[model samples]
Target: MTSGVIRRVLLSVGVIGTGQWLLSDVVHVPGGGLGVAAVAGLWWLSRSPKQPRFREPASLKGWIERCELVLNQFEELEVVLELQGLRSPREKELRRIEGFDVPLSVGVVATEGSGVPATVQLQQALAGAASLDLCLANPLPVTSTSWSWPDDLQELDVLLHVLPLPLRAADLLWLDQLPADRPVWLLLRSSVDRSAEDHLEALRCQLPERWHQCLLPWSGEAIELRGVLQPVRQQLMRAERVREGTRQRLLNNLHRRWQADLETLRRERFRLLLQRSQWIVAGVVIASPVPSVDLLAVAVGNGLMVKEMATIWSCPWSSEVLQVVARQLGSAALAQGVVELSGQALLGLAKLDGASWIAAGAMQGLSAAYLTRVVGVSMADWMALNAGVAEPDLEELKRQAPLLVARAAEQERLNLAGFAQQAHEWIQERNSCTPA
Candidate 1:
């Protein structure tokens, strides 16, 4: 109910009650009706329904789709396939070429001079491939032979045939001289009566950048193919390297920016959450398990991150050489100060003392996650505090030392069992500490 309506109702009840009360109490007229009416009015005012307001939730699906679409626009995989004469062998070749695994549009341009045999094959091969405008340049006019092409592929043409004749051998000198609208791959007799290198060089000199050469023998055999696509391959390699470097650089930059932005957002989220939550201790069951410093920062920045804690704790250290190390950690050697036990001692400490110290610290809340702001912790302090652990020498355990073997075997079993038991105890302990 609105405050306005409530106020008016309360006012009416007050006036009516006052008039009645005046007649009864002041004028001595009897009846307890005025008080009852006032109570009823107030109750009615309190029982009205409130209007609801609605809001839309924040969703990023639309934005994500738009971003993906934009990224896909940069994909470059277009390649054009060029076929000159589609004959018997050419038909088979065309089928194979079209069948090749390439996600590109193939544009075939047949010469008008190609015999009817080649022309029929070309038309058939064009059945399932992309057909750019076809140009025919024959001496005599032919019947309407191109009528049966698919509607989408009926764009045929009649152009001058400027090769293999009056267009002298030297006339074909410039492959670059071809029209820019076309992507060319000359299908010539592999073993021409003349030199292959000279022929290729002549065509290479004349063709425009649009021309890409692929030599095929008259027999259409794959084994006999020449021109290993070397030039095109080289160009593609250079372009690929340049593109890869650019893409890698862009990815790195984007990742770095994302990390920076996320870090700031996380900090904000943490602050907001803290304001809305309470952190009461269930007594000092364990001194603020939260360390006064961040463990990850200390480990990484100080170069003391645990390297072999899992192995020493979980795997046998005797036949494993690591069990012996676990024994040394809680042993007198650890208490005697920085006692450096090269083999067994190091391994034992890594498993037992190192794990216990770190685990105890973690449970106490002396973890990196809580101490993100502390910057004074150093590598030495981290190592001294058991934040750093080393690998166990499995190979050495199998060596000729009897004392090592005996101790390793005992330590290995204890380390594994201790690790499991400790894990369970920590969980129970932490749960008990959290306030209900």
Candidate 2:
């Protein structure tokens, strides 16, 4: 509250107390004091800050219902799963065709003598996973488990896990094609006659290098192996590009959808800031010419500030525009016969006066025609006279430094005569206002 209001409140309280004492017969000093204390205590209590209360999370049923609703919107999806287990060489080969059959479905079953049952453990461990995969756990006390096609469990892809058997023989007998691409990982039990090293060495000589095979130890319930599906770098690059495109599209859609909603616009703006502020502005600051100039100044300042934040030493700006300006400075230094000074030094010199190097650089890169369209001048008149050029037309190069640079480059190339005319007009206008 304002001090005036506080003073008025105090004065009002005093007036009321005095009025009660003078006009009322029952007004006692102790009662009046007690009343005033009570009022003060109430006011203090009312002015205390309040804490916000949190609401409980939505129910599981509600979440599930929402997920179901979303899923209903989609018409098609594909789900695939692969399982690996420990078994005999012959058994593995026999089941290989079945495991690698059409649509590539497999549920690997571990043999009892294969120890620990790696496949079963993996199934039990990942039971609560949010995936479409369903692992059928095979327990110990080995018995011949046949692949059954049950009507109720038609979706389940079954495989009797075993070791290496002849691929041609298995294919001939099963009359099925194997998934040549996917790999089969082996779980080595301690009970095996040969060490895993021996098996791997023998297999390495027979199999192609492209076929990925890893040996994992079966220790009780755990089957451990370190492996990776070799990454496709080209595919990853494409995927990143796709992801960036998707992010941009999503942002564009959201901005369009909520441009008028204040809360949404605020959130979008904040998100854009987080994303390096490359969002498309709906002409928020540049509605008027004066404000447009001011907005440009602020943008330039922010760019410089961002550059300053990146450098260890105090430098003016490191943005692309400033680098252009730095190049110009270097060129100017070179023209002045100071060839010993580096480009970096020239850039530093430009920044020393608190002038925006980026803006200067922007000026450097512009062509005469573009400068005419934007700032109406060339930089040829601003720079020292060039050899074999007509006294550097001062009338045609009357714009600001950056614009002059652009126009000068354009004039050198002679891209547009109309722009030269416009520059002449601007120069004449300036000359007309000058004192004799």
Candidate 3:
């Protein structure tokens, strides 16, 4: 924290804390200075988004640095998966490429009949587009064999799908499936439609959300379409000036794919960890003699799960640091009666009530396990966000706790059916093995 930011934060906290102390009804929690400071700091952080950026850089060099950070995040994800004896898709090193060249490559796909002639007119209109090698939507005479988009122009920076209305279902599906990496313009050649603006209102209902603005209405000669493209040309020109423009766009495409792959792998590995951890906690609870012992046993086991989760994110948060997060989330859950609610809702959630559930201390054990998962997963999110930044102290964790816990609870509620089945099976197995 900078001296100025720290001074301002302290001043605000001091005013709030003094008011809180003077008011008898307010909470006076011991060792809650961190949570108190968290409230002010979070508000301050929200107001100022230009917080000390670490990986964010200027020009092409900045892009390269962000790419490195993404690579490292994936590398950690791979390690986490590997520890579980599960192999993840290898994340190859993203290195700097010298003298990189980028082109505003555009692809055009047109409907048959009059659409083919309209595309040729478009080619003539854009004859001076020197930077881009625009795809000829229909280079050869119209035939069933040439209906497909050109295979050679697979890597496109922009696309123009010329359609003679009424629009076809196949065309709408194609546009929907197309990735949002580049701009796509739907060149409509409808005889009945007056202007492209007329089709814009209609196309909004059928087209994907992203392509709503990229619609171009063509009524007169294809050469007149150039006027419609002025805005598109300006957008492209602006992109060209940004971080060597074309090169940055291509890099971003690759980076987005890498991050997406990492996310899939991370979720798979995290699921496996949660499954193992939750089952173990359930076993501990079932084996314990009483409700008091069950809580203690569940806590001890849950702490280990939290530790493993932190290790996966490569977080430097100590056990004490983790406990602070757990404490905040747990208090929020308890205050909202989430603990009691989850237990009571378990059978209702899964719609399962059986002899297995009626077994000795079954409700206590199952609820303990369920609550462990809610708290553990919530901690994982906190760790993941802060792991990239500086290690957040108690204040930051407490500041984020209520929101994160509430979100996690809502998400878990949606998946209660699957969890209920798992709990039912676990209890059945336990009952079968234990002496009656």
Candidate 4:
């Protein structure tokens, strides 16, 4: 008990130290003067919290159904982009999993020499499967080796290559074409008990080392056939798991591609929506003298933008959720002094003096717009991370504020010139619309 306790304590310490190093030193992504706590929080939030499985998994049909629904959502997102003269054909990739099979079948291929004798050996071998651990149906056909079969040869789960003594050149050519992903067992047979293994091992260097284990010596008798077929049975038993894993992988890959494409289109829509929301907030700032209701107006405008963003992601949202994201980003932006930095940036762009009121409205408009962009971008990232998860905890947004705000700031800084031009035009248009 004492040794086990000490070992566990040491393991816990090592794990903590490794996680600390990974957060503090390995991942420097949030490094634009952001605090170490922010980086640590970001790394923590990014990991999936599911425990590892040690046993065989149940059927994944339910998960596959959810993916199908997501594919339908992808089609809807595609229609949104198509309205603006852009076409995305990737949603159609979901057709790959339409008729996927969950079970695997087996096939056999035999060499030229000892044709009838090889058939007898294989027949007895498959007959012995009754005593094996796995229940396998023996599709017994004493088939001759061929390069390819007429019917769907891919249906075969395990291909057993039967070898008779005295290796032939044609046998090597036949072995070369067998599928690499599927296992091919080399069933070795001898007519007499005095036969040597060297004659059968002529192609040893050319074959994989793992295939060498499948070499079994038999004079083709019924009693010993069961053990010969055990290894082949084991490989076939894993076919269902392999097929399930493959289907899931195909669906997941398509989902990722759809996500990337969808995010690209949604980013453009986010900027457009932020432009409209910030202009409304700017008008509110100018309309109110005392500024008590200005915050409410900004909140309302941002709430609508969040709702629209949720619609874009095919998710539902609430006002409370909106407040959580907006409040966190607003405070972090101010804490990082990005609001002042943005104001100073516009003052330099307009080439106006600090005391000049000429660009004040434009500055106000752009500042509000900048914060909205950061919040919208941050919300998009959070939604993407929490998609398909029902009722994700809102507190994660609170904990993830600094990293989300910093990352969005970095992203928005890339197109500052274009945004400045849009902000200037927005202010001028609003000024013209006002009564003289």
- Indicate the residue-level lDDT of 46 in model 1: 36
- lDDT of the candidates, in the order given: 0.30, 0.30, 0.58, 0.54
The estimated TM-scores of all candidates read 0.18, 0.20, 0.50, 0.52
Better of 2 and 4 by TM-score: 4
On TM-score, the leading prediction is: 4
Better of 1 and 2 by lDDT: 1
lDDT: the better of candidates 2 and 3 = 3
**Best of the candidates, lDDT:** 3
> Which regions of candidate 3 are displaced past 4 Å?
1-63, 74-102, 111-114, 117-120, 137-154, 166-181, 192-213, 227-239, 242-253, 263-367, 370-436
In model 3, what is the error at residue 39, expressed in angstroms?
A: 21
RMSD of 4: 15.8
List, residue by residue over 157-230, the lDDT tens digit for candidate 1. Answer: 21122233222333343332343322234444333465655565655565543443343223333333323323
Per-residue lDDT for 1-436 in model 4, tens only?
3663454334333333333443343332233222222223223222334322122123366545655666666666557655532233443444546456644544555643444334455555554333222122232233444555334434344556566665556665565565444555776666574454564565466666665676765556656766867776665556566566556545554555555666776777777777776655454334323223223323434544667777777654454454555556666766776666776776667743233337434466466667666666777887776544344465666788789878888887777777677766666666565457
* Best-first order by lDDT: 3, 4, 1, 2
Expressed as tens digits, the lDDT of each residue in 329-389 for candidate 2 is 3233223322122222334444433333243322121121121122111211232221111
Candidate 3 global lDDT:
0.58
